[model samples]
Target: MAELYELSMLLGDLEEQLVTCMRCGMCQAVCPLYAETGRETDVARGKIVLLEHLSRELLKEPEAVKQRLENCLLCGSCAAACPSGVKVLDLFLKARAIINGYLGLPPAKKAVFRQIMTRPALFNRLISIASRFQGVFTRPAGEILGASCARFESALLQDRHFMPLARIPWHAKMPETDEPAGPDKTKVAFYPGCLVDKVFPDVAKSSFKALRHHGVKIYMPANQACCGIPALSSGDRKAFMQMVRCNLELFADKDFQYLLTPCATCTATIKEIWPMMGQYFPPEEQEKITALAAKTMDITQFIADKYVLQRKYDDSVDKGGVKVTYHDPCHLKKSLNVHVQPRTLIRVNPAYTFVEMDEADRCCGMGGSFGLQHYDLSKKVGNRKRQNIYQSGAEVVSTACPACMLQLIDLLSQSHAGIRVKHAVQIYAQGLG
Candidate 1:
């Protein structure tokens, strides 16, 4: 059929990259899903085999191969540990697009991605409406964690503890700004990703405070679109491109030194994924995306590198203080190699004593939509992370990604553990006061 021919053509782009995988099984040692399920098909090597079969037309049912591919967390663990430097995540994303194009996305996903997610104004309107009425269906479940649970039995919500949407999201509170850089200071264009904008507005506020204290000027546009990872990870390339263009157009004329985001996932998507997928766009658009990607920085990285030495931390502080531990989101650590900067930010905050958790860089298993599509598997991986946090003996757990914070809250709340979750920027911002 013509559809299969097109699918093969799309998959052919990755053929040269795919052959580089030597099937060394090094990925199994780092894969979170493979450790939990222990299935060959769940590991990167097995999925690579399936992709090769489909690309060569050796597999009859591409849908089965698609299903096997969707089982991954997209955490980039295998790619980070790959001996041959296979670029496994890149191959998996493109392969998903190829196979999903062949099989067609489900009606529900099609509607959400195309109709709602790609449109910023419509998405904000719907989320605002949901925030106003969420209390009627959800009740505060974890007072210390500040999370909520379903008021009644609901299959969609799954009795999971979640952060309620802020009645006034960050965009609604501080709509737009074009603050010029102060003398000898860096100017940044801030992209507070969806979770920070809606559910954790305080993180956005703290980032603003920290940036302001360092005399960094900001250009924050209102009605910014999603970073497209949710769509791209779901294999909806059309929706992903739409979101990317929306953001690129909004940020086109702004002359900022850096494009910073408080969310690790968003920073990684813009810096790494955008440029990697730029070949799909027009040359001009590709140029803009590449330029923007070059300037993208995680908030912690920006502050730690530029501002840490400039400021003074009270070095004479007592050891007996509020103990804190940090969780490295996979996108920040494995994807972008940003493990040290967040720790550096924490170290510069003298009010809190930093403690290292066991396996600090392990994936917390909140691969964006991975938690929603595969909740049981997600929870299993999260519980292992929770045990590590518990063993760390810290009262507060800090992480760079809002998604990781959500997963940590769920695991701690379900187990009735007393550990609280905060963004690294939030902790660093407090010490700035």
Candidate 2:
């Protein structure tokens, strides 16, 4: 009971943001989960009201509130569409931390987030071992997508087609680099996010290829930690802070004009979430985070801004190329306002014809761990995206986020759609050839 009181007080700190929700139901129009579930509790307005009641100590069941909050995709659709401009993501994230801090995280997550994920070396070593033995338990599900399914029925693997861990992760291939910036060229610190590093190292390689083609210098540090979104979203604030501090120590005082990443989630987490959570750290540590966040940029954003948008391309160079469509990542589009830059990167690729998919900015339904927990709902939301992609009649589908790529690969592969999934930077990199 005392703990509940503490939780309520902690949640009370977010009351100002909670009151901003006008209950206009505008969030319903954009929320992918609500669209499928058709439940008020699935939308941001209902969640905000629940948080409000809990903060006031009027709600007795903190568990129920936490469940309702976890049901959300945290795609930022609600916050993006809110007329009152409420910070929905911020409110939910903080509320989650408060409640979970009181109730305690689940055993499995507590172990993974606190034990394995927080330690970069151990995390890498374990994943590397898993990669070697994955074939014993999983079988190839799709050739084009390079996805695998469990050989036998497994609760965790389920019926989803997942990208197998890379045989040689990006870090293993090229642990670190400190290439100098050429005359009149920009120098960037490259961060290959977990998925890109382990599952899709080619994306990292392609991004590096694109950077080199554009005369950009590179600096990548070893022993880099996860961006901490996984921990933060799971309500493990301690683990999240540990990861942030780890990354801060790595990139601090490094000479780079911008921090670059191929994964949209990494870019958004660094540029937005890191700063939002910086308040928990000391003043000096906060300054380092703020400076690093300012320097972060999505690889697509950097290339498009520095090169593609500035140079006029000859449209007639390649008329009959692969028909490619773009799926905008929620973080890149809503969180960072980076929709234009990724599309610009695609349009400049002469080897691919840029075709627009219906609702190109619709959420892909991955939502990080949200997909793992509520995969039935995740697949339903993702099916809508699949229909749009199929209807586009494009031979290839591309996105800036590796997480979205994983979701797209699973959805498209389940239906036997032969469409290839590539990062925008990968497509742009092909043009360099």
Residue-wise C-alpha lDDT for candidate 1, range 338-411, written one tens digit per residue? 97778778767777888889999999988778889888999988878998998988899999999999999998
Going through the candidates in the order shown, the clash numbers are: 0, 0
TM-score of 1: 0.95
TM-scores, in order shown? Answer: 0.95, 0.96
Give candidate 2's TM-score: 0.96
Global lDDT scores for all candidate models:
0.88, 0.89
Model 1 C-alpha RMSD vs. true structure (Å) is 2.3
Candidate 2 displacement at residue 171 in angstroms: 0.0
**Model 2 poorest ten-residue lDDT run:** 309-318
lDDT of 2: 0.89
Candidate 1: segments with Cα more than 4 A from true spot: 1-6, 55-59, 310-318
Q: Candidate 1 lDDT (Cα, whole model)?
A: 0.88
128 Cα displacement, candidate 1 (Å):
0.3
